[model samples]
Target: MFAVPALSGADDGSWMEVRSADSRECIMAEQRDERLGRRRLHLRLRFLAGESTGSYVTRLAARNNLPVEGVLRSMGIGPMLPVEPQYTEMYLSRYARERLANLAGYTVAEMQKRLVGLRDEFLMSDGDKDDWEWPWDARAGYIVQACSLCAAQRGTRSPAWLILPDPWHVCLRHHRWTDNSRSTQHPYIDLSNLKDVVRAQQRLNRLGKHLGPAARWVFADACSILVRSGYLEDPARTEEWAALAKQLGEQRVRPLAQLSRLSLLTQDLAWLEVRRLYGELGQADYREWLERATRRHGFTFARPLKEWHSQHQPLSRGIPELFSDQSPPSNVVRRATGHELPSCLAAVEELSCLPWVRLPNTMDRLFL
Candidate 1:
């Protein structure tokens, strides 16, 4: 049995040493012993930013030329059933985490900070007890491949999968686009020919920064409005995304790529509508601004604007209630009360309940 070294504190960084064994001995011992409670692998792989636990483990196993299941099993971690080890997250107990950290030459704190999957509270068990089983039915987040160019820069030849929650997959540095598909077959779309899409992504990033927690809701609302207004389906507006699809050898334009453009065009107006809901702006002023904004994009909002007015006009304007036979529900009254804007949380809750509005699936899965 190989002697286990004491882990020093995270500050001094000396806890990484896993007994001074030579390469041949380390490999032989790791293979010979089914339980690697005190043994460490010969290679110490670095964790990529936002990389999932599955990705890190896969990389570690690949670097050391060992089976991923073997590495996992050796550390007292095993799946509840047969699973694609690289695609699913590994839930770990405290002792399992410490063993993993020791194997990867990272302190527990460092592992928690660097690995995105480690932060999930559901996957983490309490106490010093070493529970080795991964739940078979636990809902796993989608993991997609990171930018190939970025992965190459990090000295990895294999694709690095990440748990990215961003609505769009754009690598600004390489100008490559990947969709939020779980399938790994599609190649990254080149954004060099689609400059508008690139610019829209940049604007979307800025919008996220400006709106903070409300940004996803605001963007979803914008998408819903644009789809309802027929702006996103217009031939002229969709031509760019169609061209991009053709360039990328896809049969059809991805709805998300097209929606990204439409949302960017109308996000400012969506935010204005939010302000109007909060009573920050008068109904008349908001209508006027909406008219100007739509006109700038060569869209006349005559019918759509009128419909919007009828649906959302303040109750103080004496518009008849949708259900005139009875008093409005308290939630409806709360949402539509004049100059009494609902809090952000209330607004989100109300918007989510609207049957006609459809948010992107990604937003629904993640933020909602």
Candidate 2:
């Protein structure tokens, strides 16, 4: 049996007894909580070691007579080991926590207790610890990796994938915000050039804090819809669009904007849209929302709803799902920028949030 080395400078001290057998060096891990529901687990190991973490876990498992998965699970790491670690290390989703018990001197249980206490880390509920698996299920969950700025500041490269209680789009510390881009990853957009957009993000944060999670979820949903409505381009299109644009700028109109745009009045507009959607969505059905979205985008589906796939499906997903707690997809998120938007989202927020209200009970009958 391979024996763990005895501690030299105080058994449970911050500094551990490092015992190297050839090129394999002992890696240490500890949990650091910087935010709610997303504490970071730092693994202090010579990543230069020739072997993969999975190989190390497998070797340890072979040495200890425990299954490789058991070794990882005990450390709060992943289950099915991967040959190479994925880039999604920032959040709770990554699961490679086993390195914390590097010393053979301590038991796995003891090391976990140490991890829980090290950062004064605790969430309201740790409930149903995640089972790390491939092909993640989208209906019930989401995975957000760590903020780039946070990882860079801390010099951590292997951040875990985490399931945040609410969707967060930026690292306020770095003043960098991100969501889905035109590509796969959530690339950070430096907000340094736009002071107003920065204020807008801050206001959104405050709105979330003041109203609580459910309300914030509703508001983000509203923002996503408003951005998609193309009302931002509507003012340039027709007299009807121009009239509404004039009305939005009028003193009598209300201010409304969300993740799509940031302004002094972002908070009020978010709140307004949230209430607006909650009421309208509560009363409206999903079918109408889908059909109206098609008309708004200046297109209509040629086939039946169920037969509609990629092209038409994009227009159909947000409204019904918005009322639910689940996070919306990339199409809905508007990464704030200097681009001009509607003078007031008040005119368009609800139009996007619940377009079903404006539509007739059926699709246009033969253009009659």
Instruction: Give the Cα error of residue 50 in candidate 1, in Å.
Output: 3.3
TM per candidate: 0.62, 0.36
As a whole number from 0 to 100, the lDDT of residue 291 in candidate 2 is 53
Cα error of candidate 2 at position 152, Å: 3.9
Q: What pairs collide in candidate 1?
A: none
For model 1, what is the alpha-carbon lDDT of residue 19? Answer: 31
- lDDT over C-alpha atoms for residue 101 of model 2: 41
Q: Write the residue-wise lDDT of candidate 2 on 1-368 in tens digits.
A: 23333346654443333435344444232332222113212333222111222323333444455544444434442223232222111112222232334322333454334323111122112442442322222221123344554554433343322222222345567776433121123244455654555676677667755544334333434444333443332222445324533643321111112233323223433433344334442224344544553453343221221222121222212243444567344244332111112211112223233222121101111111
TM-score, prediction 1: 0.62
In model 2, the number of clashes is 14
lDDT score of residue 275 within candidate 2:
43
The local distance difference test score of each candidate is: 0.53, 0.33
